[model samples]
Target: MSASHTHGDCCDHQDRHQFSLRKALIPIAVSALLFVIGLLFNKALNNTPYSVGEYAVLIPAYLISGWSVLITAGRNILRGRIFDENFLMAIATLGAIAIHELPEAVAVMLFFQIGELFQDYSVGRSRRSIKALLEVRPDTANLKLGDQVREVDPKSINIGDLILIRPGEKVPLDGEILSGQSQVDTSALTGESVPRTVVTGETVLSGMINQSGVLTVRVTKPFAESSISRILELVENASSKKANTEKFITRFARYYTPVVVVLSLAVAILPPLLIAGATQAEWTYRALVLLVISCPCGLVISIPLGYFGGVGGAAKRGILVKGSVFLDALAQVKTVVFDKTGTLTQGNFRVTDVISENGFTQSQLLALAAQVESQSNHPVAQSIRQAHGKSVHKSGVQEYEEIAGHGIIARIEERTVLAGNDRLLHRESIPHDVCIVEGTVTHLAVDGEYTGRIVIEDELKEDAIAAIQALHLQGIQTVMLTGDNQAVADRIAHTLGLDQYRAELLPEGKVAALEEILDRASHTQGKVAFVGDGINDAPVIARADVGMAMGGLGSDAAIETADVVIMTDAPSKVAEAIAIAQRTLQIVWQNIILAMTVKAIFIGLGAVGVATLWEAVFADVGVALLAIFNAGRILR
Candidate 1:
């Protein structure tokens, strides 16, 4: 009985999870059919007078294509909001019918729905793209209950539950593999194409697809707190935080629509009352034409849609822009500050040279260093351990103390092991040999005597130099802030041609350094963007005008807090995102210019009684269609 109940619950949940997108396209199909029939009726009545049959046919066509708009106008009227597009289109077409222009009224509503259909399509396309990007959500988990493996909803599983994942199945929840080995594809979250190899005791995140092996994983996090769930939450709330341009357009439409309504009213009443030659019928016709031009649907619809397209295009390239505000800020950035380790460089250290003093074997020095360094996970320390090539048990080490940004101090069986920078040796009053090296040097002192210096280096990313050059080409300055020594920082700065460098800084120091760069950029009213691999740089990323996180191997704090997440851990995406923002802005301004110029000309002619209803329709509906298509160019 319990098994059947759970199975039924799963089936019901699966039905709800699947959305019928075809249902949304039904209205579009109906509107298109009515549009075609309306056109046919208009062509048939061009040379003939319409009777009751024609009125009956045209009225239904208008209602079939525009019932939703009519209902929305009525509802908004009851709510005391009457100057929106629905009201404008409804009033204009109803007035045409009152003037006995039956065919024109149907045509107006048909064309209006055509424009509306495109608007719906644009909005739907954007929403669908975001949904598809988040398609990583797993529907069911293979729950392992003793010897039985049963299917269950992911939400029904809890922490510490054992789950089995087969080949090509998504990891249902964040967990650690209890057994088995396989390669898991994490491209859904990180945007990297390469599948990561995993074995027993390795933790795997939700939304990753397992390939080539069966595995048992112990759930570590619930479904609500998973990675894909958080991404969905971010996207769902993104639109509430509008861009500056979107807000301006919202306020503009609030006044622009009502004012134009009053203008149309004045054109209808005042001209007939003040001018002797003007008749009521002629001026009222002109008033109807003026009403059609009053709606700024072209500008209002296209601008936001253009920004959405830009964001969708960026998503396709593995960049997640949380909102248009960040996209707007990205366009105006004059300076970009970068975190050094794990950002500009690979963050993987390799020992270049091991200098030994006083006839001590190099192997003895490395073994001593690894014994102490194995206690820490610092990148340089790991490099030393890797170079040592032999594992040193940590049980023999005693009294370990870590000095921030400098080095470490430990005792290996009564032999004091100091493995760190020059500052660490100086602080301990240990006389150490000064070794001039191009790469980072970790000084090692044994029993307060200078032994040798080990040189470790983190090579620059393959695209770091090119990324800096591209930013320079765009007239943007670049700065690097790291906790490395001055020598290492200067070497990287010179090689990358950066404008400035701040070395040997703590996390707080990085934030302070960012403030200095931001203050300098204030003179130009420009923004500053800080890009990092996203773990230790969260504070600086939060303080910048735009926080761009390299998200291929991202941390949750950075991915959630940063406004922009570059999916691939490549610096080049930073420059590419800026280009997309600039291009979006360019298209927005073009739509503004195109819509305003055409509307001004048509409205001027409309006010003078020279423009016909046909001209008015084209000025309103045709311009909207053109601007929407123009906005589509952002994706290209």
Candidate 2:
């Protein structure tokens, strides 16, 4: 762990909120103290209606609590940007003061400041959750300079520079361990509590804490491009890309605020001027109440805060929904497509069966196949090498060649060894009996004679079946697409009870399949999500309505293209993210309905002079507080 990253309790998510709360308390306490003093002197004693001495104390109370808001309103009005909550509060409270309702005027600003403090607290909590990953990297690194070490800023360290990480220090940058053996805690970045053991030649990422043993690391990435930095950048900028609902609310407020102001103007002037019994004092008081009721504080604060809290909640659960737009889309998802390998099944391949031909022992055929396949990084090749249980001599191979999809051909010793799929043997004019297998297989030939075949099986993830069942229960249709052979894809798809499966799909084919699913969802009034974790899946991830990446063990490309990233290598997180999105939307709608319904009734009452200025404070600031409380549930 870096010096900054301690093995502290995971429940340390409250520090930021506490800090914001401290700053908010000063204003809240001051406003409430002065407002209460004004109330006692003006209302409780002598049944005093209005007095010059009262105005002296009450006006100062309003100014103390709301001077910033008044200044902002004045500045915005001068800048021709006047329709906002600040303007609404400023106008309504000042109008009340003009009518000699000193207590109500002071109360309005005081309560509004309290509401703002709550907003700051709630927003601060959400921000901490979203930006928690920013704490992964240490502020400085122990740089190695000419056999001596000195602490330096991580930003100042260049790529390929050498650094030392002692026990309890966070790895400052993405680097390879030059010399060390230690278990590094990666929970901060990957969200997995288990510590990963690392040794020489192993790559470690920035933000991981070294549990034990000192490591000399060769940095591979600069601080700016490190994992933690990229994730922070993605999260910080996510809010800028507003959801459709947010855009609609923005447009609604732009027209709605001005319209309400004009209506309040008509209510104040028209009825009193035209009607014989109507008095200017009563009508203008009603107009002031109307202004407070019309402020869109509830809708404006609750909607975006709802999404912000949702994102924060998701981060707490090890899921990263890049933006509110993706969260909204995930809630409406009806079709979920999955890339077979690394998504549904463990990408790790294991040799399950071996066959021999040409009077060769299974062991000999395995050894020859392993030697030829050693040069390839394909999962099948790795599995074959692992199964052989013996290392091949590098000098034993004369010539080696890797034919893209066909596999490998090499001159092992004096004999030519061919190890690959059925296509490789056929291309080499070698005849071999077709082998029946349920998983991926590599057919081998030696010196123009058919040697044998090895079958490699990819086990399904422990949670794959459960994840599929969960989606099914949610009424989401599931599909699987892969480049694997038809039989293997068919069996896995059937075993998992998926709705559909497409086999032998290339990278482009996955995109084509995703487009078709999206077209279908468009007609069905739903969204389509594609789950994947590879470079090949990146394009499909970017094309889908919502892309969920298996962030842990997933390729960088897939994570970058995905709209949502499941921090663990679990398929079940997809369902978890959807549940969060749905809950978040539910809270947002609840707030919208509650705010609108209450405001409408109050606005009607205020226009007819049936509601008092005190009631107007409840309509605006009180409703905002209630809606905010409703929105906070999304984070929990």
Candidate 3:
């Protein structure tokens, strides 16, 4: 007698469904058993019409099975909301009872309850699957407080606090490793299977598991701002931004139920009064059947479920779609614009070539350059040191100076060694053979004499070529935008077979270039998506039709401004996101067509008296279950 049903609010509905199955089973069983007894009693009475024994047995069964529907319908009517599945089922069954069809009335309510139970089970399973996919939020942290570790909630841990991460335990907060070494598993966040090794001075993020060795970490960010928290927040709130198809279905159902009710009333009243041979009882029976068939439960439940499945599926692949509306936009993207650094190319710089001059050997040139560049922490300097592959001792070095926007001037072992860009050489009047280089270059000078030049270039990611090819296969144009010189940009574009390239653009220039791309796209063509990871890429990312950020190495501004975050920092996932969106949309439309087709056929048959009340119940509940199952396919 305590049965209740919910219509809107997907989270509330899912919570109710998660627990409703067990509560509903006992009442349904009792109602079904009593209905069987009532049928046997009616048979014993030789098919008597309106028999007292039949009413006594079957009326209780009908009330027991349908008490929730009747009460909900009455409450909604009082609240001035009269059109829903509950109203439809209540009216149809009550009309059956009025026509002395006690068995049919009881059967309808019992079958409807059975359908509700199945729906509960289906939705609960989906909710559990999605929960399992996003179960990355760490529950506790081991706070290392002065030689004693205390188990505490991750949220209670503050910045600058020390935390001990044991082997096989998850890192509780984003922090730098102060001591110890470990191989950490980042699959929970990045969807990558390979374990990453971490040592002292390396930073580890939250939600990563420590595979081996203990790590003493100094926390940098609180739990609220951790990577895991941001991802969970995006997923939990994704349903709030529904797609256009979902919104349209919601509005369609609101008015659909009322129109069906009016049409059913006309079917019952107008036929008997207008036709000579049409009896009121027969036409009324058809009206009840029509009412039962007209419920829009399939469309109401399946559309949102489909989108929820899509979001969960994307999360599993290290792609975080902020909302279903963004998913829709991704499916229609015709052009994918990429930022050169850290997006298609690995942002890490490496020394590619070393050109020597002025009687300096390659080894001596690199060693001298590395010794001077060692005083700097720039990425280009780091690449030089890494290439030298030896530690530099500053013991005999003097007068270490860094020229902003130029290079470095340091006197090592009484030698004035200069390591910087061409501007530095030009400022010192040191003449060099090459005034311009294809890629990033650093010129070295000793005692104001040109010694050599080091060529450093950012390497393309391993999957960069494959990613562009995949997008091209989908008929999407691929473009690259960068501030690198024209030679470097042309080389990368030709190597990746990109459709276009724009070079030497500043941050604002990148935004203007994106706008021009947007302008060239016709309204009938698709949208433009921009993929980037740097702080400078934030503005253009926000301007794109669908902004995708490389979450693994992307700056905070880029991630916050992006509509979709690719956690793996793989350009290939851009194409994958579009594929998932297209698949979700396809399944959604299939469900819509399936539900509408079944309802139209059954509604017409019921009105013409060819379909009985039993068929109408099957048509309504059966289509809903099928659609629910179909929507769940996206999770797979």
Best by TM-score: 2
For this target, which candidate reaches the highest lDDT against the unseen true structure?
3
The TM-score of predicted model 3 comes to 0.85
The list of candidate 1 runs beyond 4 A from truth reads: 1-50, 144-148, 156-162, 175-183, 190-203, 215-221, 352-377, 381-404, 407-419, 426-430, 444-454
Winner of 1 and 2 under lDDT: 2
Candidate 3, residues 1-636: lDDT per residue as tens digits?
Answer: 001123442223346444665676898999999988987777764355647778878988999988877887788778777787878888999999999888888988888777667766766665563465356578899999898999999999999999999998988789999999989988878778899999998889888999999999999988888877777777788888889998888677777888999999999999999999999999999999999899777777778778888887887777888889999999999999999888888879999899999899998899888889877866788889999999888675689999765789988988898988766887899987755566888889999899989999998899999999999999999989987667789989999999999986767789999999998875558899999884557788889999999854325675578899898868999999999999999998999999999999999999899999889888888988898889888877
What lDDT would each prediction earn against the true structure?
0.80, 0.81, 0.83
Residue 99 error, candidate 2, Å:
1.5
- Displacement of residue 546 (Cα, Å) in model 3 is 0.8
Candidate 1 has an lDDT of: 0.80
RMSD to truth, every model: 6.8, 5.8, 5.0
Q: Give stretches of model 3 more than 4 Å off.
A: 1-6, 9-13, 16-26, 35-42, 45-67, 353-438, 442-454, 552-555
Q: Per-residue error at 50 for model 2, in Å?
A: 9.7
Supply candidate 1's per-residue lDDT for 375: 83
- TM-score per candidate, chains pooled: 0.86, 0.89, 0.85
Instruction: Count the clashes in each prediction.
Output: 0, 6, 0
Deviation of model 2 at 498, angstroms? 2.0
